[model samples]
Target: MNDEEARTRLLDAAEALFYAEGIQAVGMDRIRTESGIPLKRLYRLYPAKEALVTAYLERRDRRWMASLSAATRGQADPVGAVFEWLAEWFSEPDFRGCAFLNAYGELGAGPAGVLDVVRRHKAELRALLAGIAGPGREGLAEQLLLLVEGATVVAALEPGPGAAVRAREAAYVLVRADGTG
Candidate 1:
């Protein structure tokens, strides 16, 4: 494969494994084995497992931002956009939890860079919330984030559409109460 395709394959493999299996539980060998690429090629792309994890998070973040941007199009209202943006997540099959958050949880803390990705992803989510939530509601954004995470957790536990529905309802109430609904 060419450079771009190879890189994409490696990242795709990492995303699948990292999401399906825990980040810490997955190793470079498995990533290589799953990708059908040789170990040497994998190393050339990612020098370390941590770097691969970072790349996985980055790929996911980019996809997330793209989805959010596309889904919220023509809806200038931030809160409304957020609710619609969430539809993508709720609609997905096998949605377990936030991959970044899950990675952090599974890894049990690591080098600064690993945690940095989690923090950065979180900040991005919060910023999206703040934009939709309107002015002077940082606390509200954080709270809404918690609600989102809670919903994700519940959905993961319950294994049905009901959990997502509940989350959307709770989110509607939360944002509406803040006058952004």
Candidate 2:
């Protein structure tokens, strides 16, 4: 395959392995094997494992946000739509909490860009929530962000989408109380 194709394959393998397992647990050799890319080529494509991890997270962040935006776009109740989207995501068979959070937990203190990626993802999410919450409701947006993150963690720990459901209920109350719902 060409460079682009090889890069995509490497990233695909990296994302799957890293997300299914954890960043530190999956090595470059395994990624090479999974992607069917030669070790030399894999190293050439991503000079280091940290580079690969950062690339994986960057791509995932883009796709994740895009999916969320698509799901909530044009909805009459954008805030409710956000929770509804989370519920669906939580119910996915391969659901495993937030990938960015998982990466942060695994490699936050490292010299890698994992922390940067995680922070950017979160800030973008909060911005989305803020837009939905509208101007002058920054506190509400922050509250909603906490609920979303909390629900994601709780969902990861528990079975089913109970956390998202409960979070959605709480969000409704908050929004109503804020007179925005």
Candidate with maximal lDDT = 2
Candidate 1 per-residue lDDT, tens place, 1-181, comes to: 7968988888988898889878878889998988888999889888888888988898898898777766655675555556555655755775767787788887757756778888888888778767656689887888877876676677666655565566667777877787754
Clash count of each predicted structure:
1, 0
**Which residue runs of candidate 1 sit more than 4 Å off their true CA positions?**
76-81, 84-88
lDDT of each: 0.76, 0.90
> Candidate 2 lDDT, tens digit per residue, 1-181?
8999999999999998999899889989999999999999998989988889889989998999999988888999888788889888899888888999998888766844777888899999999889889999999999999999999999888846788889999999999999987
Off by over 4 Å in 2: none
TM-score of 2: 0.97
Q: In candidate 1, how many Å is residue 76 off? A: 6.6
Per-prediction RMSD in angstroms?
2.2, 0.9
